[model samples]
Target: MASFQNINIETQIPEEILIAQIMQLHESISKLESLRPCKQVNSLFTRLVKLCTLPSSIDIEALPQEVKEMRDSLINLSGHAEGLLEFEFSTFISLTPEPFKNVTLFPYYGNYVKLAHMENKILKENGMVNAKKVAFVGSGPMPLTSIIMATHHMESTHFDNFDIDEKANEVARKIVASDAALEKRMKFVTQDIMEVRERLGQYDCIFLAALVGMNREAKVKILGHIRKYMKEGGILLVRSAKGSRAFLYPILEEPDMVNFEVLTIFHPTNDVINSVVLLRKPKA
Candidate 1:
């Protein structure tokens, strides 16, 4: 592996080497349950992160067509493997009596803990007390954020986990089914976020997952749908990326959020992968 210390990232590094490493990372993510190569995954990811953040010299759009294509490929494949990791664990946890017992086995468990704290802080500062209902859009197989909020943060708040995939919804349901109390407060729905329009107004807060839309244009459309259907005063917490983190997730820009008032954006400088933007739908 070549040093990424001070060269033009786009030109100095051989494209073949970069592609090979990325494919290796993808494979590593797939076999995380068995392989669990923590150190290797961390090193590769950190280098790629630095590569993505190297000064304007790494103008992605101006790069060679092949490299540009690889850049997109890296983002899409990384997101796919991330979901794959979650699904793998979700299936395992669904079978266990205590779903969270093995949660720390996942490399990104701390990230979820950080997100839960961030959500609690944002909701508290905004006087969002005893939220009647909260909806988490694009909630995948392991609705950890929702589960964490239900048990640790907002004990009384009811959560609706929405996913487009039926199998994912089934697994999520099973994960929450073991706890009788959580089973009462958490519900998993196998429906697209776009189809939840009629029931959107009932939610006091809505969370947009990181992988909901893989690109900026798609994110804009999904946010538009959320804003159109949700209540005027509803809070929308969107998972986004900043700086190096953009390599793994789509970055949501302010210009795309025309109608929503940005309350606060928390960009964690730590291990948290996604930057959270807390917004509210302004009254018409």
Candidate 2:
């Protein structure tokens, strides 16, 4: 009955109980993929998510060396498990010669559907309902975001998906290869966003995936590349996390986008794990 409803956001979670719960969650999730369609992932995080919703009060800056090290290790394991789950599902779908027919069966496919609606709502509010060309950096092996957006939201827009892994791009390409409509609108590029040093001013919108930079330092570096190439006044959508969700995904901070004007910030209180940050590149 370790409950956090009465806990103050400013106070730390009981250290011993926190550590033990994390250990249990870690041990259980270690045997399973992080994002399984089963109840396993949800059951594991149900209680933890409650506590994590308001951010862990554990002050990483004030922690003892041993406690901090242990926390980092457990968090890394949790994050790695999540990445594996996405890869696992993507691999399964890729094996199906024509993945699009059954791609919606993806365990977390509904997440992207809701996410698409959220992004569309945001874009409409910002008067960017009809983007001509879009780029999704770190589109991953599945490319769910681009797939959902291209197929449903911006049906007329061209989507260019970028991934550093050639194999991932290959899989993503196959997912949309059978659909002539998608094939005509979506293109997968096997390249890192940082290497595309030329001014990427042609894109009307750009999306930065959660896994693009798993760490703060890496995220900062990638943002620099984006700022340099992103069209002046273009829109950039970033996926991030808040509170204990940081254990699975990197949290975006204001410092990361000092040059860009952040327009909106959203963190779903429901099962949706990602927080959305909308930003606009300032014209010099």
Candidate 3:
């Protein structure tokens, strides 16, 4: 059993103690084949969430293998818990301004920079000078990827961000509105991927967020919907995880979609696990 005795939610927890609790909880959960509705697992998950929420300046390279493994296990468990509990954990976390402002933004910015650079590389390789119109599916509370890409290209690009969650749309809109430059370049669309398919051909580039669908079947359906509407020669950038973090989303080694050809996979330059699958809709 994992004891979170040293964890105090009201105060900052030491990195060593936090890591120890994560390791214990991970060990307990790994022994179970399937997670059932239980107080222990729930408690462990709650504690893990709290620990993750705490401010940490620890260097990733200095962390032990056990600590790293435990952290990854917790993320996997968190994803499973969201499905089992019928809750949108990531969305809920995003709704809260404090943790997102302090903790989430740091890593998200790192990811955004890497993704922007990779997009630039891919565009250049494809002989495309600029992505004039871009659509970001599952934009969440902060469309960091779109924002970062827009910043990288200056005023040349326009972004249409779509998300099923109205709250997420509102939050993202608010963020964009705060920046005068972003206000002119970005717009949030409160629609599911299927609903937005009607205007898909308008975008030069499309970003499929990793959490766009709950499962593989849902993702395939989303992909199918886009295939029917995306313009010929338009680029589709599907964000996914690599290596151990692949559990964050349904791993699509090779997307079996019609009319789309895989161009390349963009791996992150930092610790962020996201990899972008660059696909293009071929000209007829």
Each model's C-alpha lDDT?
0.76, 0.76, 0.66
Residue range with the least summed lDDT across 10 consecutive positions in model 1: 53-62
Q: Put down candidate 1 lDDT per residue, 1-284, tens digits, no spaces.
A: 75456566455455445445545555554455532234655565566665554432233334567654555566786666567767888888777768756666655777798889887888789877789899999888888899888888898999999999999998888877877888998898888787778799999999999989888889999999999999988999999876545657888888988888999888775566778898899988
lDDT of 3 by residue, 88-157 (tens): 3334444455433432343236656766677677767876566788898987765767777776663578
Worst 10 residues of 3 by lDDT: 99-108
Model 1 bad stretches (over 4 Å): 1-68
- TM-score of every model versus the real structure: 0.81, 0.82, 0.65
Task: TM-score winner between 1 and 3, please give it.
Answer: 1
Q: How do these models rank on TM-score, best leading?
A: 2, 1, 3
